[model samples]
Target: MPIQHINPPGLLQFDAMSQVVVASGGRTVYIAGQSASDVNFEVVGGNDYYAQSVQALRNLRTAVEAAGGSVENIVSSTVYLKNLTPEIAGRFLEALAIACEGKSFPPHAFSLIGVASLAGADLLVEITAVAVIDAAVAA
Candidate 1:
């Protein structure tokens, strides 16, 4: 794994994310957007941002693991939040911490965007990620 997480001197650092991630010499894995839906495509959380965020992050972890990588291998991610607010962001951070089993969330570059809606009315968050794993480690 040749991934370097950097938070430049002048840039603000965050516990949940890295300012930049540089990865080389690995198999790139592009994970599709994962939401709070279960295997049956039923929304797991209803009108609860924290619950939805937890489910979404869990789904993302599953996707990465399926690609023979873990959350630590993720280099970048894009988060889409419907009706974003400070409270919602706070809930998301809490959810992320829980999803990581109380460990620090992976230091992956992240972009959060606020949207008006998602694929479904109940969906509150969706996450898409990109990860890199050693060629031999790929499934």
Candidate 2:
């Protein structure tokens, strides 16, 4: 594996994500921010944060796979949420679990940012990720 997840002892560890990630000897892949838009550029979820979150994560997965990598290859991510709150964040986590096929999301360095708006009016969440994959896999 080219990626290593670490939650140092002193740092507050969360089951859904890792505090740190170490990537070695692989081609770094930078994924653009993905929202709930579908292949037709239409938003999949409307006015529903959880639904949009799930769709956004699914889009992120699609991008990673397109780069010849899996969600497990993700080393870092930045999540942007519109009008975020604790309850909304919980919903996002739930959506993440669902996106990961009922399993916990792959551990990775992550940042969550509350935003006033996104590219689309209906988009409630957007995810940007970075992954490291073997050169052979990328070929």
Best by lDDT: 1
RMSD of 2: 3.2
lDDT of 1 at 39: 91
lDDT of 2 by residue, 22-91 (tens): 7888889999999999998899878888889888888998999999888888889999999999999988
**TM-scores for every candidate against the unseen true structure:** 0.92, 0.92
TM-score of 2: 0.92
Tens digit per residue, CA lDDT, model 1, 37-119: 99988999888988898899989989998998888888899989999988888888888777876575676898888899999
Q: What local lDDT score does residue 19 receive in model 1, on the 0 to 100 scale?
A: 95
Task: Please give the RMSD of candidate 1 to the true structure.
Answer: 3.1
For every model in order, what is the number of clashing pairs?
0, 0
Least lDDT summed over 10 consecutive residues: which range in candidate 2? 130-139
Please give the distance, in angstroms, between residue 77's alpha carbon in candidate 1 and its true position after superposition. Answer: 0.5
Go through the candidates in order and give each one's C-alpha lDDT: 0.85, 0.85
| Candidate 1: clashing pairs of residues | none
lDDT of 2 at 70: 88
